[model samples]
Target: MASHIVQNPSAGCIVKFMQGNEPQIAWVMEEQKGKLRLFLPNRRETTLSPSRILPWAGPSYPATQSKDAVVELLNRHRERRERLASEVAPMELWEMAQGEMERAPAEWFAELGYTSPDADAVAACGRALLQCKTHFRFQPPEFEIYDAATVESRRQAEEAARVREAMVCGGADWFRRLWEARIGRHPAPDASTAPEEPVRGRLEKMLRARMRDPETVEDEALWKQVTKGLPDDPHLALLLAMTWGLVPEHYNFWLDRADYESGTAWEEPLESETQELIRAVEEGGSLPPAEDTVFISIDSATTRDIDDAFCIASAADGGWDVEVALACPAWFWNFDSALGKAVFHRATSIYLPEGNCHMMPEALGEGAFSLFEGQARPALVVGAHVAPDGTLGEGSFRFSTIKVAKNLNYPDCEAALDGVENAASPFVESLRLAAAMSDRRLASRVEHGAVIIERPEIDFELEGEGADITVKLRPYPAAPRAQLLVAELMVVANAVLAEWAVKNDVPLLFRTQDVAVPREYAGVWKSAPDIARVVRILVAASLDVVPRPHAGMGLSAYSPVTSPLRRFTDLVNEAQLLSVLTRGSVRWSREELSDMLMHLSIRLEAAGQVQRFRPRYWKYLYIQQQARAHGDECCWKAEVAEENDMWVSVSLPEVQLGLRGKRSLFGEKVFPGQELHVRLGKVNPLRNEAVILDVREC
Candidate 1:
């Protein structure tokens, strides 16, 4: 037994004390009142009370031990601690399972020199290892661990189970659950009313089989399988189809209403007779060539289907003799044939950011019928004499063949016309004559109620594919002089042909726009919004057998006789003109023409939607990509074009994006013509959505 003596310890006095049931040796450093400062053999110092210290009994080393002897004692203790640590290092149950141990018990831990207090404590550790066996594989009964191969096998089994469960419950049922959750309604409790197991199973199987190979929802067998015995709900069918990957997220449902193909492929290959005719045209026939005329075509650099080219020479009667050569595809085209019917179905070429879907076959549009330079192609040549004041004399129209002198893009023509010195440019005189013609035409149109909107055109070109895709936006240079020249020439050619058609009593399709405008509202409006308002007030232009005034162009009559490569209406008109010149009769009567236009109108409306919406889709995608690349802090300078009580319509002229913003962001001061700085957010290309986040005065 140890005697407990409560006495104050002096400085440098060695003492023994109990530290958590283990005895420790400490030397007293100082004593003050009720506290003693003690330094342990491990060099840790602490303040304690007198009651905590015990009198020393075994050795008086604190007074007689040399510094070397004390250090040697510490070194021996450290060696013992390190040996113990090596023997009892905490083993991860997983590491233990990887070794020779098949089954471990509490005694096994003791045999391995584990440092737990008792058998029960070791057993508690074994229980913890058992719980870890789910992620780690362990033998049962006394659970010890297993190797990596066993763990991987368990993981694969779990994944297979999960996949099976998902197959049974995922496709349509998952979509149905989401729909129910979104609408805040639970499924009906009647199991009998629910879709039968076999039917649901079949649907799921079909969906899973096509998981990697998706097809359009229009596939008859797939559609039948998806909708069999399901409720007659279009929304539910659409949701299931979308969820199962049968349709794209941004798919246009309106596209399904029409039967015409929208890709680059034709509905059917050209008939053998049509092919022969095309070959014949390409083989070069004997035809009268125009005399001493220089025909130059002004178009885009990428223009391939060259339709019309022009020449301007001084007439003997104090006027400019204009010769407009229209590419005569109608000479080979059979209006009553199947190829003609196919063209009528398409109605017009669809232009998108990706490219164009040509109305005529490429073999004709870009080959034989295309007015390539140095190729003497058949043409409907229209001759007119323009006076110095730009008044047209009597015009003459006939069929002839002419070689195009030059094919000049807008830039080249504009540069040459601006007197920017190019070597031997042949179209300068013609360009000058074109400018005079445009001035005269503009003055005449302004005298009427023609409104021209000169909005900058934004051209979108997509490069690469997938994650590497980049959208390049360039402003299509509006070369006013060059554009006006082409516009005036096309209009004059159409006017000349329309006059001849009327005088010859030929029943041709005429573009008529008869709107009841205010008698006082007769002036040329150039601004976009102003022109848009005028367009809204006017009736939509339409095709008719009867000749009528085109109020928008301020013409007594108008018809699109150019660009037969692109527009089916122009091709139809060309065929009519050709028949009148050759056979002295029209190809189609007024009734037959009206019947064709009715069908063409429906198809045209659908094609128009594709043309209008697809570009807008890509434009929205561009904005989305821009927002993601530049982040939220980027602000675009926008002008308010129109405003209402709740929204302000703003136009981003740089990107040609017109979007609306909340009126509250800009306060009541935001009105039309107000320029503002705006930030975009929540741009979703798949949904074709964008939102203006904030707006402030510039």
Candidate 2:
């Protein structure tokens, strides 16, 4: 039949077909039904179906000819078709074909350009259309002219693909160079030699974004493609960022990992709110009358955000009249505003050996809202009477403008209280009275089954920058006297406020430790091993809306309302207390407070992790340096806290670090309260790992 004859190509007919994207010219050697055996121009033979061949097939030759003759014929035709294809412009043909017809065979397109076209001309037109996929799309027997919109979109996609290829080719070597420079393997590349414009910017942006959030990076595929040859480093993104100068050396990856923004840049959005609060402070803010009493604030020498201060005097009934003035940002804080939400998101200030990240903007936390000395600032004052026997009476809460008379540091205050030479100050009498009150309270707390463990206070400092960073630990001065006085007074104030909240039927967050403790575990513990033994039986304090006994503090309930500038929960509690005192009702309902606490608790837990890990990282670094300098002679005093068949948990009281080792490492006779000298082994700060190499009884 005629249809059967058309279904197969005869032998020696030159056919054009696509192997992949490239068009190949081949000679038909033999035919069986719809299948054709073809010989290509490169002397290769293949079996293909008629459907695989392009519609433009031409000029027949005799199959009985030798292989050399067939190859010569195929090459000659291919050269002619290529020359013709170069002469044809796909866009010109597309412009002429569009709106005239939806699609047509290659002969139709070729004839439009040439009035009398041959098979070679049609085949050339087909080849040109195949290469220009943007304007023309081939579908079997015809070329489809794309619409203007689709053509433009395809043009952009093609350009993007070309640029992406260039970036990957150029950026890989560039990044590896930077990483090499960061490790001091070689000098960094100059700016002139870096990848040009959009490529450089694109790479830097992707690297920084990946460093900040690796888990949710959208360009993970591209990242993998570009960083194919780099080392498999978990902190590779961070290291590359550091090398690229996108971040500094020793950058706190934890902040980025936690999605916490670390600088004052986040404060920009709250400028207007900060200015309003400053104006309020400068113009004597809208609040009740100023309190006449002058309060004294004590903090570390570098502290700037002073949130709590107190003044003591003799009461009418011969008891001590203690007035605690807490920084009152809650008075003007609008929890629904942008500024409020930002503070809530920050949750708490992070104090590291390097620096502090304040929860509130410094303009408010360290300026207008801070309890700076001699400045008239708004405050929530807690007035209560402390009896001679360290008993707290009913408390009175009020919001009023107040001024701090003095600001003192712990070292000077300690020396003053100890009557050391050249440390005399104006508040000697007040200091003595405060110390007496703290002594009485400590005794009372011990009598009430409190578990008090006093461990060493250690401070860490960074000496140099970058790779030469040296961490040094020192004993914290003034912890024995001045720090104790401030700690006790703040506790008294918080307990008083919490008790008042319970009596007034207001919903407030209280820190409760409701577990029972043995009476023998009540006294103060000072030794490293003794403190370790006592700490095992004490329950951790927790926050809740309902009041409950705090076994650790020996109080019925405790609420932290002092450091509003540093802690979000303190600000919240102050808001609750200030609301009832000023507006005569609670600002948040019980359900709302509960829901808020749930989110705040999660944030607090994350913040606690940062605080907990950062110091230990430095401590491990310090230990590693020591071991390298001293070898096996490097020893640290650790007190065993608990032991079982499988493990022995120990505490390094000097560094405030807890560690555990395998039972085999400690031998068979290990017990709690045993102090030992240990040599650390194989410390890797990045992995957060350190092993006890050897141990001996101290």
Q: After superposition, how far is residue 596 of candidate 2 from its true place, in Å?
A: 2.4
lDDT of 2 by residue, 1-698 (tens): 00111224579788888977988999899986778999987888999888888887777766798999998998898999899999999999889878888888788888878777776788888899999998888898778888889899999998778768867888888887887886789987775777887788888888778776777567787788888878877778888877777777777877866666777999998999889988988888485589779789889889999999999887666558888899999988999899999899889999999888999999899999888888989998988888888888888888889889989888888888878653337887888888887888878887887788887778998999876788889878834777777888888889998898888778888889998898888888876566767777777787898899999888998989888899998999999987887778889987888899998888888777778777778888888878888888988999888888988888877677778888898988888878898878988775577888889887
Q: Could you say which candidate leads in lDDT?
A: 2
Worst 10 residues of 1 by lDDT: 1-10
How far residue 421's Cα lies from its native spot in candidate 1, in Å, is 3.8
- The TM-score measured for candidate 2 stands at 0.87
Off by over 4 Å in 1: 1-258, 262-264, 271-274, 286-292, 315-319, 422-424, 518-529, 684-689
Clashing pairs in 2: none
The true-versus-predicted C-alpha distance at residue 67 of model 2, in Å, is 4.0
Off by over 4 Å in 2: 1-8, 61-66, 83-118, 131-138, 143-236, 243-245, 285-287, 316-318, 421-424, 526-540, 696-698
| Candidate number achieving the greatest TM-score relative to the actual structure | 2
lDDT of 1 by residue, 393-465 (tens): 6668788778888888887778888887663166688788787777777767656666555667888888886
